[model samples]
Target: MLIVILPDDSRREFDDGVSAYDVAAGISGGLARAAIAAEVDGELRDLHAPLVVAEANGTSGKTAGTSPAARSAGAREVNVRVITKKDPEALGIMRHSAAHVMAQAVMRLHQGVGLAFGPTTATGFYYDFQLDKPLSEEDFPAIEAEMAKIVAADERFERMIVPRAKAVEMCRELGQKLKVEHIETGLAGEETLSFYRQGEFLDLCRGKHIPSTGHIGKAFKLLSVAGAYWKGDASRDQLQRLYATAYFDKKELTDYLTQLEEAKRRDHRVLGKQLELFTISQTVGSGLILWLPKGAVIRQTLEDYLKVELRRRGYDAVYTPNIGKIELYQISGHFPYYSDSQFPPIDLSEREGQKPGEGERYLLKPMNCPHHIMIYKSKPRSYRDLPVRLAEFGTVYRFEQSGELNGMTRVRGFCQDDAHIFCTEEQVADEFRGCLEMTQTVLKSLGMNNYRVRLGFRDPNGDKYVGKPEVWDRAEASLKAVCESMNLPDMSVEAGEAAFYGPKADFVVTDCIGREWQLGTVQLDYNLPSKERFGLEYTGADNAPHQPVMIHRAPLGSMERFVGVLIEHFAGAFPLWLAPEQARVLTVSEKSEEYGREVEQKLKEAGFRVTGDYRGSKLGAKIREAQLGLIPYMLVVGEKDAAEGTVTVRDRLEGDIGAMPLAEAMAKLQAEVAAKTVRQVADGGAPPPPIDRGPKNEY
Candidate 1:
């Protein structure tokens, strides 16, 4: 007999050889039919895998919950939870299986294709194959058609476990050199390996798969294909990566495809060019963002908003150099640790023709905290000045691979709204709580209320983290306590997600499209102030030197990335306060040109970003131009309105409102701008086509 614990903490006894499927069947027929996988003792397993109970006394036996003595003996209790198709975890399992099916289809279509690795990403699954002939978008239909046939066959996925040596022999027999090499290089320590076979197609995998191919349904689609290096090593053989997505329901797939199209339409790169916000030129660098005049305005507005809040919260703004001595980072433990992602050090010796010891080396600062740390150490403090807050919109650089560059979102050079606080241990909780509140306020101010808080703690098993175990524990506990004391959104504790020096709280915001982006972070560090490092200290009431704890935070983590996400979040239609060009004056004809110019001048005098469209163009053509530019308001001064000394206001989305006096129009726009109100544009409403009125209107 085997004792099983259900999800609800209920206990059940079953035969020793019974499987998870049998347990599901015993519970309900519907559950058994819907069961795709099972999570056993926190590890996902095949639904049909036999249930085994291992005792705590280093013994294996067929036993049930016989007596309290059995529990007292420390026998391991088995926990089994059946995963259905509807469970969120089931999507990844299905996607993984879908990759196998896709691979099988590819192999059947194209002979002798060497398979590398097929893994599931956040959005979909991709399989890398080393093929003589490169796969193109044109071949997607054929590959997908083959996948449909395999799905229709509903072949059961059978698993087999074998010795590692035997697995290598099987790979060799199948002419899968990549698999053989992987088994030798990656899995050399494993004594046994598992393989899954469906029909005549066999592959090596560690799987938690659905019972059969039919479970994949007809909701799978093969997306684009791209070239990838083997194991992401550029020097290795290039492989074709075929991307695809799978869903249990057809409607979900349809919705996902629709979202994809909408995402393309809202792409920051495309909108950035059309709206003339920012640009990336290969001549300057791939990941360096060049802020155009309008983009600079948006960035400046964001900085000013954050600066006001920082000042109200007792933060002192400071400036730091773009480049710092390499030794500075070495002392902070940022160098040699993040060296792979950082630009090469600048050699003063090479330029001065001096020996290595005679000259200094400099690095493009990868982080702002070290600079802030130096500033903290620049002054002596008493316990009365326990918490010192320093803030900066510091620009930093990292040498990200060319492939990873994605406009402003993933740039080599970017500015961070970074701040650091040095406080006593007793004040850590309140300081961290303040940072959390400030971060929440920033996100809320921008209409990003739908977000999750993730507490990133150090992984005990990982060697990447610095500081003592006890120090990390205290830091993590302080963060957790602060979170508990406050009412916040859904929060999760994630291990191995913390920075090298400390534990951090990350705010991940979900956009309107249901996609999540990590936008803000607050980290507590005990290592930076330790004696072995920066040696930051303060004098206590007892006249004794004491170390101060440091808190590093960035509510809007990277201004570039924040703005990039904002562009997509609002679809390039900013609110009145944030709009680069708040309003444009459009004249119906030359008869109203003077009135349009006067309206523009009046708005400009009122401290609004306003422009005049005095070109002799049709009123409709001018409106279309303003709408396309996503200007928040268009003040049309037609012949009648010009004579009446009133302007007809057209909201970007709501269109025209009746003529209002100039004073009234200014007040209305001013109110909206002052309140920083967010207005939604109607769905499926495309901007009117642009008419070539003349050269002046050309973007």
Candidate 2:
């Protein structure tokens, strides 16, 4: 017999080799029916897999195993519980099964179709296929009907483990070349592999799928089809990706689909065009935003807001050239380290010290850190000069692949709201706190109150990080302590999201459509002060030279992406102050044309961005046009207003705030803009994107 501990700390004895399903069945048939998966000693896996006497440390290296995998199998007992539909994790399992069912339906509908990969996402699942005939939305009805039929048939999903050689043979027999390539290219050293099969359908996957097709209810629908390169490699064969979504219940699925529709309505690219904010011209190049006059005004407004905050925090604004010598980046470890994302370096070997391997080439800057570090090195400093804060709205260039560029959010040439701080060890906490406060202030001012802080730590398995392990450990510890000091209950620590140089406090928020965006960030570092890089330092109170720890922060992240998200967040009906055309003077008739010019000039003289629409149009028609443009206030001047020195006020979304004196209306607009009011809206309730929402891992 084996001992299994329940969540409530109760121990139950079961026969040897008993699976979690057996234990659930013994407890209650209802539990057995509701169970979609299992948690065995903290590992979520197939419910039918044996709980074990003991098992070797697998994917999660949490439990220490003294023996090898061979000896560890069935060695000791572990805690066990059947996972039910109520658990959020079970949704992924069900969705994974839905992918298999989808693949089966696709195979049935078309002959000679080659399957690539199918994986469940946060909200749904998508499968990739290579076929002679391209699939489209027109084929969705037939595909969905076939999927429904498969679910009705109720075939069990069986798992099997086979030696790598045998798995290759099986895949070859099924004519799945991609599966063979995956194993041969990456898993060639593995001893064995696991696969799941449902009726006649089979695919290679690392899975924890639902027990049977029947477990996937009729709450799934195919969404859309898009082009995807094999394995996400542009050089590989092009394939079609069928996007689909699933949920535990039909209502949940309905809600999700409705949210997706709303997302489409709020898409930033569409909104950008509609509002005449920004554009991307092919001749000018892709992923480079050409801010129109209106968009430029909004961006300038945001910049002014940020500048005031930066100064209030004691940050000194500075500027640097767009391109720098390669040696500078080599010192900062960005040249060859981030070469893939950087533009090709320009050769200037003819110049002095511009030798081939001497780091003498000129390249577009990938980041702003190295330049600021140079400024810090330009002069010697005393302990009194500790905690030097530098800021810039610096534009940087990157070589993003063509397929990845998306409007303002993922642009090649974008200006970062970048800054770097050099402070002593003791000042690290205080400086970090200051940056955090600034970040919170920005979010609050923008009315984005719903956000979570993420501590980005290095991944033990990744080689991308620089610096000594002990140094990294201390840096991570200090950052974590700062986060704890803030007493944020919703903050989370995510491994492998760190920047190349150090760990960071990343501020992440979701857009209206439930997509998470990592916006603001603050980082701490000690490695760059070493002799190999720029040895930045300040005289200590002890009169000895001490290296200063550096903090890299960006509360707004980038002017481009910030504006992009704001446009979506506010649905382009900007607040009174930030609106490009804050208020428009519409004439009720030609009789009010003189009054309109006077009202427009008065608002403009008051430092408000106002425009006059004196076109000979109907009053009702002109009012609708102003509203469609999302102007914050529509100031109408007619016979009554022209004669009475009063202006009729109509709020953008609100019908009207009634006729008020011109001075009174001006005051109201000024107060709102000065306050930078951000009215918080419920999730998916964000004034739908005039919209909508990163960088390399940002979006």
Candidate 3:
């Protein structure tokens, strides 16, 4: 007999070889009916799979062979639970299924369409199809309708394992060119292949699909259609990709759609245009942003604020040229490593042939670390000068694929709030802790409190990373020790995701709409060729030259991406200190224009971003316009208030706060600005109130 433990600690003993479906049936008929799949010791599997003998070393050393009779006795345990298709089963399965469904629907509708591959993505799923007739958006509805009918039929999804040659013959008979190609490509080592079938549709797959088509429900939607190269090679065949999304429940599907809509509404590209902050004109080209005055103001505010913080934290700001000679990249080892992402170098020989043998070549800077390393090497250093932090808001350029060019998020040219620290191995822990604290402070100040830390590590088998095994081990250990010592909660470690040079730790923040963005990062690089090529050395107290460890940290990542996130985070409503136009003084009538101008000047003198609304418009219209612009405050100066040396303050998102003396109001505003308070207002006329959200999760 075999005993299986459930999530609720209930155990069911069954005869040997009894499948998970039988266990569910023993629990209750309803549960058995609801079971679509099962998780056998954390590995998701088909419900029909047998519950074999428990393995000795279960996950985490937990045992799976405990007897049900030993209820009160302590024993290592293994958990078994049923999984529905609705659960997140890694996007790969979902995308693969979506692709199968798409192919099935296509074959049913257009008998000539050929299949290639369908894959799941971070957000959704897509399938590629080769057809004589090009697919368009207009065809999505019919395809979706056909899919729905197939789902309603409740056809059983069956899997079969067959010999490779037999599978090839079957595919050839079906005229599935792509399947035959996939087999002939010799990517698989097994003699047998796995195939899935539902009704008249069958395809090659390695699957853990829902038991029946009915499990798909009505929560699927076809999103869009686009053309893609078959294998991402320009010279390869072109295929049409059908994008779609599926969820476990209708409400979840609705929520996803609603979130997508909200995302579109808060798109930086759209808001950037509506606010007249930036632009990317066809005349200039793609992937380049042209920041106008308004955008520049916000960018400057962020840069200045970060600069002040960096300086206060003992960082020395530095600047470097936008372009450098090709040899510099060669010395830095960036040429071969990042060659694909860099713009081709400018060949000066073509222009200056007279200077023979002096054929200088230059390329735009892709990162600031190499230049910062040069600065560190320019002078001698000792143990006393250890932990030297160099910072820069350096602008760099890279050639991003045109298809991947996002508004400000992914651009060709952008400024990084980059910094590097040269420290002894002993100081690595403290320096890393400081970087984490600074990153937390920056995110908190920007109202991004919900974030998690990811420790990215090197892949032992990969040839891309630079450092030796021992060096990589030490660096990764140091970072891990720092994270553990700091007791940082909600931290996860992912191996094989490290940068090409070294291991790193990243801070990922989720926006209000539940979309995650990587805002800050700290990397431990033990092997940059520049350090060796430039012969950098620092003298220890023992008078021996030692190689100082280098730490690369970026609190805000890049100015462009940070601002883009900030725009969406606040929905264009910036805080008082960061707002371009903080307050506007409006007059109830033309008679009070003088008082409004005086109030604006006084506020400006007091170090507030203030403007006067002296337009020939009604007082209510002016107040409404100021609110729409998301100004922090609007001072309405009427004849009575002007004569009384006071102003009626109208708050954004808040209605009104009766007249107050100009000096008192200014003092209050200053306090709010200094405290970085986020004031919320009620629907009716009321004073602005403190934010009601509780203390944020700080770890």
Candidate 4:
């Protein structure tokens, strides 16, 4: 007999080898009707999978497409529960089934299509296929139509487990070379394999599919098609990858689709060009960004603002060379661990006796930590100088693949608002809190209020870390404590997202139109200052040398990405303080041209980013152009206003506000800028309105 425990803690006895479907049916017909898959002891599996004891310490956490890991050990029994569409795992199961339905549709339409792997992603699912002809948007309608017909047929998906020999034979007979290779190599040590059959379609897949094709409703889409290398290897067979998405109901799908449209409307790449803020040139190179004059102005303004805060917080600004000796990275343990993402090291052996990994080969600085460590080590330190903070607007380079580069958000050469704080071990907590406070303060000052704190830690399953398990545990506990103390509303921990050296607290900010971005971060590193490694030390009150705990922080992760995010967050209409061109003076006629010049000069003398449009063009055209440029304030100087020594001020959002004394107008604008006021403009006007984006994809 098998005993199944319900999620509510009730237990029911079933005959041995009874499937999860039977268990759900025994409980209630409604549950049986809604069951998509089942969870056996926290492991997601097919409804038809027998409820049996899970061997050894193996977890049933594996989902569709991942198949099952070797479960040779059986120290305990497996618990079971049915999974419906309401559960998150059910979407994956549904999407996996949807992938099979898509594959079947494609094969039915095309005569000689070869299938590869189809996996479910966070947003959707995609299948790779070796097609004889090219596919495009025009084919999507036809493909979706075929999928609808398949779903109407109500075909059950039957599972078949076979020995390795039978799996190989099946693949050979089906002419699925990819499946044969996956069975032979991908599952190299497996004693058995699983396959599923639906109607005339058969696939080498371990599926937790819906009972039939009819269960896959119309709330699915074939979004786009892209070329993909088989198994993601550039040297392997290239296949056509069909991207898609699915949802439990049409409304969820509709809402998500709406978000995508809104996202497209505010996409930074589109706004970046429309606003002329930044550019990526093919001639300059793929992952490199060119900050135009206007974009440079915004970057400078941000730097100026952050510099003041950094200074107030007791940070000493410094600069580091763009390139350093490769040995430095080796000592910092960044070389080969991060080597794949770094530009190839420059070999200078023939001339300078430095080649590859052996000698003084140079590498473009991939990180700023190593240089800051060297700066601290250069001078002797005592306990009184406990917290040494060095700051830099440091430029670093990484070799981001061409495909992954997206505008300024993902670029090769970018500057970090990087700072390193070296303090005593006892001060780690306070210094950490200080960093958190500083980060929140800066974001608040910039009006970037919607952000969540995430703790990034090392993955226990993989080994690419620098510190011992205990050290990582301590560092993670420390950072987690800092976050808990903050009592943030949406705080969570993300595994496998840590720095190589230690855990970190990352600020993942969501932007307007609902896209998430990783904007800023603060990390804790005890391993970097170890005596066995960098040998960095400071004298304690005990007169013995001890290592100072290091806090690596970047309030604004990078100038390029921050600016990109800012462009979208405000929809290219920056606030008065951050706007590239704060205000423009327009002349009503040639009579007021002289007054407009005087007005522009006065504002500039008062330290405002003001310009004049003494263009011979029409006054209406001038105002329209300024409005399109997203200029915050427009000052009109005509014969009457000039004679009266007053200015007719027009706001970009509120339209013509009214006339005011020149002094009052200047003071009003200045006060707004000083306060860092976040103006709420209407959604659509000459200039797009600013939006409030909560942290996206957060807890």
- Top lDDT model: 1
Per-residue error for 532 in candidate 2, Å, reads: 5.3
Native-vs-model 1 lDDT? 0.87
Q: What is each predicted model's overall lDDT from 0 to 1?
A: 0.87, 0.84, 0.79, 0.84
lDDT (C-alpha) at residue 386 in model 2: 83
lDDT of 2 by residue, 503-590 (tens): 9998887665555677999999887776757888789989999989999999888789889888877778777768899889988888
How many pairs in model 2 have backbone atoms within 3 A of each other, for residues 3 or more apart or on separate chains, i.e. clashes? 7
Cα RMSD of all models vs. native, in order, equals 6.7, 4.2, 7.3, 5.3
Please, what are the lDDT tens digits per residue for candidate 1 over residues 405-474?
A: 7888899999999999999999999999999999998887778887889999999999988899999998
Estimate the TM-score of every prediction: 0.91, 0.91, 0.82, 0.89
Which has the higher lDDT value, candidate number 1 or candidate number 4? 1
lDDT of residue 31 for candidate 4 = 92
Per-residue alpha-carbon lDDT of candidate 3 for residues 1-699, written as tens digits (9 for 90 to 100): 455789898876666567778888888898888787788877777777665645546422334455555434443344578765545562335445655777799899896677777665555567778888888889989999999898889888888878989989988988988778787674357688878899989888767667777767788888888877755555777888788877666776677777777767778888888777789987998888899778898899878878888988999989999998888887777886788889998778858874744788888998888899889988899999988999998999998766457899889999999999989989988998899899988888767787889899998878887757988998899999899887775898988878877889899887777777888999988887224555567899999998888889999998888888877777777778778788889998889988888899899899988889888899889988887787888888989988999998887866798799999889989998787665532112112111112111110
lDDT of 2 at 64: 47
Worst 10 residues of 4 by lDDT: 690-699
Given candidate 2, what's the lDDT at residue 480?
A: 96
